[model samples]
Target: MQAAAPDLWHHYGRTRADTDRGVPDFFPWIWAQDGGPGSEVLGDVTGLVLADLGAGAARHAAHLVVHHAPARVDAIDASAAQHAMAGDLYGHLAPRLRTLHANAAEHLEAHPDEYDVLYSVFGGLDFADPRRLLPAAARALRPGGLLAAATLGHYLGGAPAEPDVQHADIPARTPDGTPATMRRWVLQEHVWTKLLDEAGFTAIGVDRLPPATSGARSADTLLLRARRHK
Candidate 1:
């Protein structure tokens, strides 16, 4: 038997989850999360089966369930802490908003053709290996189903995004306050488009959403939209 690694995301969103317990009224795709395009990017989610990949705390998924009338929105996150937090905050919306604890790629692979819409807001698309995750997403979505995700347009410290598939070891903290690093993929627009096309997606489009304001930590967001071939 082997012990599991410490949850690197254990402390993420903890402070906000405590004060803001209500389901969000809006969903932002930009990195800032303050303003930008909302759920309209997913078109009409009404009565649609959707999943929020790498949904941290599931605020956006909760919003869709409460305000958009989705048939169901599975908030999927690999982090045990995030899954627990999502349940604690919006478990009352069950049946519509279901929180799942699983790796995004593994979950999608397990539930082929299970979702009509799949979107990640700086979530799985940023942290997971696109080679595995994107193909799994393509297999998991029904033909012509939408796949939307927001990711970094460049490195956070004003560096250019990678021209090819690559992952950066970004700093992270473990559950017991130990220092760690996690892989984050921040690829250029054409790189992402090419990857999506190769992964069985069509009509791929990427939009660069510049931050509302400039700052050291602020980086542009790449909003990607595509559909599985019908």
Candidate 2:
């Protein structure tokens, strides 16, 4: 058997996790994470079973559990480091907030029709292949369940988003600091809409959220919302 691949996300959000352990008070869907539509986009998750795909440190998931009163929120991240960080930060929320270690697509596939709401904040929807992840998401959500995700409207360096389904080899670093790369999908709005439609989602909507401030790394965010067919 071959050796396991390095965890490319091991270093992500490490610095912030060390200092800020409190659940977030707001949920921003924009690339800046400074401001924009809040959790209202998920539309009253109270008493709903939800999951945050690729939920990093699960700050947003914790916020929903604490403020929005979701019956339960599964914070799923494939990265061991991210999963561990989420557990360490918000495990106290227990019963209501569960930190899960699993790939977004695989997890959704394993639990069909298990959620009332599924969401991602520049998380799984950006890093995973929509052809697979979107269908799994549709299957995982009960009929009429909501799917919300925030993704890039364009590439980080001001490049235009792909008009077709494609993946970019973005730079990353392994746990040992070795240079590596990861696949990220930055498709145009129409492309995403088409994928969602084909994946058995209905009432699909994509909203563009401009960056709060202009900068070299700044890019617009596309807030995607859809409903599983009833």
Candidate 3:
């Protein structure tokens, strides 16, 4: 159920704010890293229920609610620091956006209530163990609920042809502003489909996001969209 080692992720949360500040002048405007472009790949939720797994600071959730208009969004993150930062950054979205500092699987298990949609942007689906995450997603979403997720296109250990786990790195700045690394989970494309099917989801699509024109990042990141139906 662990996505990142506690100390590593907590340190990441602690130092993330400062590192994000270094991104050009504008972020969500000048660049979009997480979900890519917009919520279009998420299909159409309109006024349906949705949850953002590993929602981080909720910029995407804010976009959906303000621009796309989901009935409500549960912004769930395993990091308390990250959750707090979300509140501080998007307090204006209170009530409409609810933040939950809980593990992705535990949160879904406890709630049990079904959601119309469950999605992530470079989020839990990318790092959390699919055995734990996908099944729990089955419990959390209503029949036919859509599940969409995006992650860095390539795996650090090369493309996975089977159900394999590889180490992933998230670059970060030290508390002293020095370079550092964080760990995460990376999986193969086929494994993802199998996991989703085993979890009670019907595979819908899997696409690799193309790199930006500037070539700042590679086209290695991939998107996985699935649906849970009875």
Candidate 4:
């Protein structure tokens, strides 16, 4: 979690303020990275319960509440600081937007078949082992429920597939700026399709959105929408 901040900041620093005041600017890009509103893939969830694994300041959760208007949303993340920020951001959502401090992979075990939509946005799935995380997410969703995620493309390791404006060569650091050994996985199209299939998702839709940037460092990210088979 802490390890991934430097890369996040490097790519978003220009648009995102280094402090709380900058969170708003940061969210649009985050939402964009997520391949637009979740409903485009997950179908409608107007009255269904939702869970945002790796809620990360709860930007997506807020969007779900505002746009999709789900009955409830359990926004989960591993970082306390992020949780605190989420609490501050969507605290007013009440009974609708709930914040949870937990790792997405382990947290799902406590919530088997609980959500109509179990989703993530550039969260645990892309940062950790996707194979393990997808299965866990599958276990948490109700039958026929949705599992949506957006992640880094496989080409990030070598060269930019498009242009990136906020690119920088910085060490992976915490929000406070301490360096850590970050863990990130960049997966190709086939690798993602195979992983989702192995996770018990029946109707899976994996697509590559336009690049986040168009500069020399632009690498495409993948968006996945998989449904849990009954």
Candidate 5:
């Protein structure tokens, strides 16, 4: 199924900078912490193949270009708008960085076993079907490849069907059309480990990026790092 959110696209495209400013402390902090994703953990990427699933506006892709300087970096997202912005943001790193427009599932299926590092940040895997997508993600990476994903952790049971009240500070629509809101589906740490194990990844690690300070829900993040086992 496609998780197209035209309304969200319109909302984000029109006010990304403002939105980023409004929630500057949280999103930027989290993005920077993951080294914008690949850059933080995937060291020695000079010649490694890297792919960012549902890369969104590719804030992480932009970071990878400057830090890891990988031989090849492919950023795929279903949103044309986000892809376009990523293209511009990564222009300085042209040829080494490329943007593709396609759903994460389709892209992973089309390029099975093609990358050394497969990951996603603040996009894609946020949905409930990560169980179905993780294997495909694992299949898309070469043997011994790494998969680093950052998702919102849902401390309670079952995916929440409603928007989260905890993220009241963010003032824009979710990349999904819901009012600038958080979905209660934030997963717990155990659920993330189980998903990676079932998908055939070893050395799985699941933990939270604690909020920048006490009593702040905005910067909380759940991180999952796993390596494929042949």
Candidate 6:
């Protein structure tokens, strides 16, 4: 029931504890691109149920526990490879973090109105079809819920694109030790915000951060926050 292809996350989860150098902070929530903008300021999450969709390597979700003290954090990802990375990073926090290997969309369908905050860091939210994800996310959130997510901003041009069929990139490596590439769905600003509105969220805000330049090209990202109006 996975929306993304199985091969997309294979190489990413390959590192073991010995072979690993160190798991760098990918999403700190401390305002770094690697981490998030820090959960304490994100919303009222402490002592509340929270889910981190697309919790690659489980950094952000783990951070929630160590820094913010959420009662429980479900770090869900569809790729076992991704979970492997999570296992390495979590060390002894496996039970506390509750990392799960299942298609995020499928998991959400079974648990309704269960989360106070549902967040993603360029995970299933940006890669899978929003038609399937946003509605499910709305269902997972209780009334007056919040979705704090980070996703890809407009890439080439700010044109509306279909949600079901799109492509995105994952940090993949070939067996020969070269960068591998894959594409999944990435929504234009209007397309994504509208989907949230249709899914029953309101006051949706997408905050665009400064672009990162590599020689000539620039990478743009957006931090989105939406509330489920009960």
Model 3 regions more than 4 Å off: 1-7, 10-37, 156-163, 166-183, 214-217
Give the residue spans of candidate 4 off by over 4 A: 1-38, 155-171, 174-176
TM-score of 2: 0.99
Model 2 Cα lDDT, one tens digit per residue, 1-230: 99988999999999998899888889989998999999999998989999999999999999999999889999999999999999999999998999999999999999998999999999999999999999999999999999999999999989999999999999999999999999999999999999999999999999999999999999999999999999
Model 5, range 1-230, lDDT digits (tens) per residue?
A: 99745534444444564344221121232422533333456657787888888776666666666666688788888777777777665656777778888878777878888999977776777642676678888889898999987776533222431232222122346545666543223556677677788888998987667545433344456777898897
133-165 per-residue lDDT for model 6 (tens digits): 888988999998898887766553444334544
Report the candidate with higher lDDT, 1 versus 3.
1
1-230, model 4: which lDDT tens digit per residue?
45443333333322332454322322232323532433456567788898888777787677777777689999998777677777876788868989998878888877799888987777777566666778888899999888878776644444532232122232466555666555566666667777789889888777777664565555555777788998
Residue 105 lDDT (model 5) = 79
TM of each candidate vs. truth: 0.99, 0.99, 0.78, 0.78, 0.74, 0.79
What C-alpha lDDT, on a 0 to 100 scale, does residue 217 get in candidate 4?
Answer: 50
TM-score of 6: 0.79
Backbone clashes per model, in order?
Answer: 0, 0, 5, 4, 8, 14
Q: Give me the displacement of residue 174 in model 4, in angstroms.
A: 4.1
TM-score of 5: 0.74
Candidates 3 and 4: which is better by lDDT? 3
lDDT of 3 by residue, 107-204 (tens): 89876646898888778876687788888988899887888887655544344433565556767654455677766666667767777888888856
Query: How much is the lDDT of residue 134 in candidate 1?
Result: 99
Instruction: For model 6, state the Cα shift of residue 58 in Å.
Output: 0.3
lDDT of 2: 0.96
Q: Would you give me the overall lDDT of model 5?
A: 0.66
Against the unseen true structure, what C-alpha lDDT does each candidate score?
0.96, 0.96, 0.70, 0.69, 0.66, 0.72
- Global fold similarity of model 1 (TM-score): 0.99
What are the per-residue Cα lDDT tens digits for candidate 1 across 1-230? 99998899999999998899998889998888988999999999999999999998999999999899999999999999999999999999998999999999999999998999999999999999999999999999999999999999999999999999999999999998999999999999999999999999999999999999889899999999999999
